[model samples]
Target: MPTTQQAIPFHLAFPVHSLAAARSFYGELLGCPEGRSSADWVDFDFYGHQIVAHLAPEEAGHRQTSAVDGDAVPVRHFGAVLPMAQWQSLADKLRQADTRFIIEPHIRFKGEVGEQATMFFLDPSGNAVEFKAFADIGAMFAK
Candidate 1:
């Protein structure tokens, strides 16, 4: 008998300013299906991972940053690593929606180890989300 390996999905719980805004951003805009919810929080099926957004107005936005590859990368952020094509499609959709990107979609670490396409943007509550893709999936963890 042969054994198959399966990828494990992660669970992340973050604060949001409002549940309505979270529903619109994560559910309607990003296309993540909704799951169980309460008056204070909601769950989103984020690219097969479980992400829960809890209402906490004071803890919603990222205020710190670090310099990375000449960009002020948000110190606190979360997102998915998608295939190249899917990443591009999502980028296009975001552009079409007139999203204000904290880091515009572009190739990062060009001609170097772990080169990839990436973008970053904030949600309605100012939570940072980064989406990225690797030309060669095998190089995702290359040194």
Candidate 2:
């Protein structure tokens, strides 16, 4: 018999203009817990995945767009998929905080096979992050 392998968390490291800003955005705002850190970088438990913010001012933010669903989606970005309720709550919280959005929260591909609630915003360092939720997670990869 073949054995099934367990899923493992992913690790991502990206540049940030300032560690303090990164902490405030990913930690205080997004609520990701702080992990190990050094003078040049910090790690965060980003919704069960590990993401590191490394201080590299020159490499912080770059903008590129690709059209999708009639939206100019950011070409360089990172994000997570959350449960619907959690995603909604977070969207509300961000709105209450007066956070500027690259793309406002909305449902895309309405009534389609892969419809989902999604929002996009840039952190203080100008790095784009997207959060999305699906009504049916089983349809995540549906065709």
Top-scoring candidate (lDDT): 1
Q: What is the TM-score of each candidate against the true structure?
A: 0.95, 0.95
Q: What is the lDDT of residue 129 in candidate 2?
A: 94
True-structure lDDT of candidate 1: 0.95
lDDT by residue (1-143, candidate 2, tens digit) is 33224457889999999999999999999999999999999999999999999999999874799998988899999999899999999999999999999899999999999999999999888889999999998777789
**Distance from true location, Cα of 111 in model 1, Å:** 0.6
- The residue-by-residue lDDT of candidate 1 on 29-103, one tens digit each, is 999999999999999999999999999999999999999888899999999999999999999999999999999
Clashing pairs in 1: none
In candidate 2, which residue ranges exceed 4 Å CA deviation? Answer: 1-6
Q: Clashing residue pairs, candidate 2?
A: none
Evaluate model 2: give its lDDT.
Answer: 0.93
